[model samples]
Target: MVEIKDFKASDCNALWNINRNAFRKSLKKESYEEFKNITENSIGKVIFLENEIIGAIFLKSQSEVGTFKVEKFFICPKYQNRGLGYFILTHLPEEDTSIKKIELDIDESSLKAKKFCEKMKKEI
Candidate 1:
């Protein structure tokens, strides 16, 4: 069973591990560090299964863009393809009532991610 909840400061280590394992070569340590820092003040969610973190997504308010930017979204390889991505994306609005739209930049190599967004009615 997977549970989605607000990220806690104590979960930094687990979040780091999830991010590292999920985007190994495509991302660097600095990216994770930046994520940690941003999550300190931004809105985000963490995915957990029996107390172990399996994925996470961060959203930052971008007034200039007129939407919430999905700063990061990652799922451990073992937890992929289970509809968790869709679940997480759909639940973002529940966190912040002020956010009207969610925007993200998916890597061209991440076809699955692009498809997921498209399925959710989000365009590139």
Candidate 2:
């Protein structure tokens, strides 16, 4: 099962490690800075599978209404095919009934991520 909880500063390095493996050499130094910025925010959460941190998401409210924007969301490469990404995508709405809309930016260069986004649209 996957669980969501507050992301603590202590988890930054661990998150970096996961990011490293997921993106490999494609990751830049700015990604770490961005992670720090997001982790310090009141929003965002760490995803855990059986007590192991496998992913994290950064969220920001788009309005006073029920819209939310997912600034960053990812699952560790090692944990990807186990359906954890799908779980997170589904769990977001299940956890928040007030969220009438959700949005996220996906890199068009990544066919895999684009496909995942398409799949999420179908499921949602």
Candidate 3:
């Protein structure tokens, strides 16, 4: 079963591993620092199955009107296509009552991301 929980400091290595495997581009040597930067600016979480982290996400509040933007979101490539992404999007709002709106952006070149967002739009 997929589950979401607070991300822990110990999960950094696992998060990096999953990130490296899930993407085609090789991350820079400073990727760890970049990860720290992103997570530090947002609320972070781990998506786990049993005890292993299979994915992760982060959010940053966008405005005073209760708008929240999805700052970072990823699912281990091996765990993709299993409906977990959509599940995360639809359920995020229920976790925080102050979140009256949610937003995300995808690179136009990434068909996968575009499709995912389109699917999320339909699902939510």
Task: Please name the candidate that would achieve the greatest TM-score relative to the true structure.
Answer: 3
Q: How much does each candidate deviate from the true structure in C-alpha RMSD?
A: 3.2, 2.4, 2.6
C-alpha lDDT of residue 16 in model 3: 74
> Weakest 10 consecutive residues, lDDT, candidate 1?
24-33
Q: Estimated TM-score per prediction?
A: 0.75, 0.81, 0.83
lDDT of 1 at 116: 64
Q: Indicate the worst ten consecutive residues by lDDT in candidate 2.
A: 22-31
- Global lDDT of each candidate: 0.74, 0.74, 0.75
Residue 107, candidate 1: how far off, in angstroms? Answer: 2.3
Clashing residue pair totals per candidate (backbone < 3 A): 0, 0, 0
* Candidate 2 per-residue C-alpha lDDT over 95-114 given as tens digits, one digit per residue, 9 for 90 to 100: 76666667766645456767
lDDT (tens digit, per residue) of candidate 1 on 17-65? 8777776655344566686787786777888888878888888888765
Error (Å) of candidate 2 at residue 44 is 1.1
Give the clashing pairs for model 2. Answer: none
Candidate achieving the largest lDDT = 3
Clashes of 3: 0
What local lDDT score does residue 47 receive in model 2, on the 0 to 100 scale?
A: 93
Taking all chains together, the TM-score of candidate 3 against the true structure is 0.83
